[model samples]
Target: MASIDLYQIPVKEVHGVKGKKPEELLTLGIASVGDLLDYYPFRYEDYTLRDLTEAKDGDKITVQATVVGVPLVQMYGRVKSRLTCKMMADPLFITAVWFNRHFLKDQLKAGTDIVLTGKWDQKRLHLTVSESEFPGKGTSQIGTLQPVYSVTGALTQKWMRQTLKQALTQYGGLIPEVLPQELLAKYDLMPRKQAVALLHMPGSMEEGQRARKRMVFEELFLFQLKMQAYRALNHDRADGVAHPLDMPLVRAFVRALPFTLTESQKNVLAEILHDLQQPFSMNRLLQGDVGAGKTVVAASALYAVVKAGYQGALMVPTEILAEQHKRSLERLFESYGIQVALLTGSLTDRQRRDVLGALQMGMIDVVVGTHALIQEDVFFRKLGLVVTDEQHRFGVNQRSVLRRKGLNPDVLTMTATPIPRTLAITAFGDMDVSTLNELPKGRKPIKTYAVTHDMLDRVLGFIRREVAEGRQAYVICPLIEESEKLDVQNAIDVHAQMQFAFPDYKVGLLHGRMTPAEKDEVMREFSANRVQVLVSTTVIEVGVDVPNATLMIIYDAHRFGLSQLHQLRGRVGRGEHQSYCVLIADPKNEVGKQRMKAMTDTNDGFEIARRDLELRGPGDFFGTKQSGLPDFRIADMVTDFEVMERARDDAAELVRRPDFWTAAGYTLLREFLQREHITDSELLD
Candidate 1:
């Protein structure tokens, strides 16, 4: 084969053949042959098809065979589809049967020597191998460098594979190495061209593995550098060390606690206090699992801010939560005579003005509300600390907006989603993380059960009993429609059915389409127990936690993630009564059963998180880099646990060296920060 200029090759010509444009390819981070080579396959296909004599059920095999006879389409009574084809592999006779690929007749000609690789089930062999091309040497030669291109709708594997083969051969040689020699040797990464060439056309899985290692390291190393730079930018500009807190109030609030705080929570709270005590602004993340008492920790933090003779503001996702926090805090800090006010979107114009006025005038000690609290007019006379609830929902930009409202207010974010430590470090590495692993004493372990649709009546009867005893219930549905493919009952159907079945009881409904006011109204009725049963969709996935709602019935429980299920369960058991979480599901598959069993077996959010990651997936594990999550191309947070530790060590060493900043090899690190839009200017406290 002759060499060619990769950059000179008309990108439009190849994309024209693929029926896509260079821009679409750019979405996959491809612009030229060099880009194409950098793009590696997530997984590889093994074309080692078996011999016809060794065919077995459930085996994915490929074989070189001949359609010695004429190919005919069988018309099943209705069109009589053909299910089998007679083929010969020298000494053996084999059957090639496929479904839904009715066009194979035009592709596979009689006496045509071809290859078939697919699964064998029952007495039938399904074929994923539908490749057929006229050989230049009349089927006498087979290509050794088999290419597998990433595919999509209307584009077949055969077409993509062919396109990649031509493009790589004609345009792959011109790409140059971007990494410095010392860096390449230091990391032991394979050459760029070799990795790309072998990735698209590899002889074995080992070759594919080598290609992946090189690409993965490049992606992760760049990600780490970006995060470190962003953090440093923030640290450079620090402000606000207002002494806002009276120990008397904090001690009184803690003493009022019904149970002891976990040592982990205590340790984390201390860390936060220390940060608050520093002259530098505090930007910390408090992450824990469901039922880990993050609220109490938040309340304790709020007390510290108030005791320091400055106002504290807590922002939650919903008015119901904000009101709950207001009431809870007012009750806990009641001893210190701390005035707490609740501000919500639902408040009347006059009420909002009064609250905002009080806040600015320093009449309010702690202000709690939804996003409405972050409005520009909502000024704080002495806003020393800001605590955001469900931190993930409020992004870094949103939280920063809230902090910007004050003179460098300390920011403390709290979440019940206990991500794996590695993922936490990767995603939130810039923030100090504190884990609340232990639950407060007297917190009853929730009884979780997995039941099927057949057990609905018994479950409803139990719920009715609980309701009759003055306890409320939360019935969570996956959607609002009846899907034949799914067994779960939706909100529209569940609410109507429950109302008809229990006419004496009031049933309220909530869904995503409802206006915020409508949702708040319905939630208000349910929280007050005016609605005995609240049948809703995942809209109730978070917020509006009713302690009185002691029973949680989640239909199609297997459909929701474990962390989500745990959070929904957390809505209950907030009261003194024992709570039960019924996972209305069938053990449909191994994954479904495992998820259901995990929910039943444990209530630990961190453990549930690890299992969820293990169960959820690895590739595209965190949302994507586009979603502002730390990208882990090959480093599985679960599998590459030690790699992260080592990488962190390496990064620390690189930064500490005097000559590290001047090294030309760090160009990629500098460029990555600029590309990610993370700059020193963003660090303005």
Candidate 2:
């Protein structure tokens, strides 16, 4: 028989496979043998032989024992069967139970030696197993470290292991090696064929770890290759207009500010100014914590662009944020003889047309808006700069479309969500990064507290008292509307209850479901102090800054990530009055408790972000798609930082080689990247 090409053979053709029909395989996304190979185990079970008599509670163990008596088989409803048997090990008796294995009754005979692997319950003196096999049978997977595949529908672990074993037996030798042999030798990495075989069936623990490291390096290396490719492609892609540094607008704007700019802010502004003067387009990310005065720095850049006879656009994530920027820019520029316009979805036809006309006619020097600014009709006459606030909220496509409006206008992306330095570099290697590490002086930190659900009433009473003292308060709920799937407090329900609880105070509701106009109006009321208590969702997390709001209560706080909780807390403590954040939650798990504790322990946004990254993996910390990072199968952004660094350096060097794309090993690597949809040309385009 011809050896099957694992990449081309369908999974349904594998021998000794049952329970997985062709259509059923499609449900699990297993179209070919290659898909099965890529379907890595989420976790592994250590089935190394262990002493049954010394087992502890909740121990996953494997043992070899002889059956003491005939297995007692009991049938459940319809097609299910349960088998129970007792085993003897010198001085102790152990009971073993298997579920839904009716065939085991005929296979497991008295006095037969068998190996059982399962979770042992000490109190019940029984080993609970959904899998079992007799020793010396054709099955070679028992008593060894085994992979537990994530199954769907009627698929079982036994069937998947058997089918995958068949594939490995037939075609594991044909698994292509992508990394150059010299590179693998330099890193002391296992060969790709050995690693693939070991990942599915490792002979020992050390071998498995070595194989895993090789796989991780390959994944991170591919990601860095894509990033470096984009960076190289964009080297001279845009013929950016170099604005003159002799413009006096930036100096005058800084002098007119109410407070002295922090040293970090000044340094970041200098970096941005240098970028603005470059002949090539600027792709930069400006990251700062809350109250770091990033807006003022951006305003300075906008002022410089306007003074150089060019228009600028600032796109924010929310309508309220756009309004806030518009008002701030108007106050700053109107006094300095620069025109500013606001464009948002909530604007009427005439209002939008007027703003568009001003922008097209070079009358509006700076326009602040949300996604509406990226619409087809919104054109700029002399657009020189484009700024996006809360950058992670927008995707690469959105930001790229906005930049396309202007002929290679300098791009400045700002985010209050402070990512760790290493992750920022890995995720955004195509862009230059600047960080504002210092907050403006005199800004007080929000005092944070994590309280149980029973103390919620006291927290509410405190909010009531704070509002009564002529200070407004914010109540944040995790959900906008009641969700049957997720049982948590919602903004609408909390808004209704607050109205009844505090009859005299004006409580307004704000959630993502509301239109842009409604959200903006509610935010306007809250900012003006007309709404004594604003019950809302995370919509107010970023840019809704009300100085008078002195208290923030996050209901069901455990449902939120630590960084999100920190952002919510930042909404308070902007004013002179002492501010407080009450996290009302009864955490059901240790991770939830750790998140709550992390929030109350420190007010530093970066520290909170680091802790959040540790608690939740990179995928959940800031979402993979939002961060523009690929979903790596084995590499972790946290634990494998050193590996990623090495891989990044290697990739950076590899891409510079003349034959990198066509070399023998690299040709296979390129094909893998193409299959994974990480092609350089696709992303660079």
Q: Once model 1 is optimally superposed onto the true structure by TM-score, how far is the C-alpha of residue 479 displaced, in angstroms? A: 4.1
Give residue 425's error in model 2 in angstroms: 3.3
Candidate 1 per-residue lDDT, tens place, 94-149, comes to 67776555567876678787776666553553444444333443532243435455
Model 2 C-alpha lDDT per residue in residues 1-685, reported as the tens digit of each score: 1112565787766675445376677888888777777667666788788886677899888877788877888998988888888886445577889888767777667788888888988887888885666767785556577877888877788777777778778768777776778789999999877887888888777888998989888888877877765566556555787888654657877988888999999999999998888888888889999878999999999989888889999999888888899888887777778988889888899888898998999998999988898888988998999999998888888899999998889999999988887788777767888999988888887888889889877888898889889999999999888899998999989999999989998999998988887887898888888899999988899877898999999999999999899888888888899999999999999999999999989988889989998999777876767777656676788888788888878887887787877776577666765664555445442
How many clashing residue pairs appear in each of the predictions shown?
A: 13, 0
Top candidate on lDDT is: 2
**lDDT value, candidate 1, whole model:** 0.73
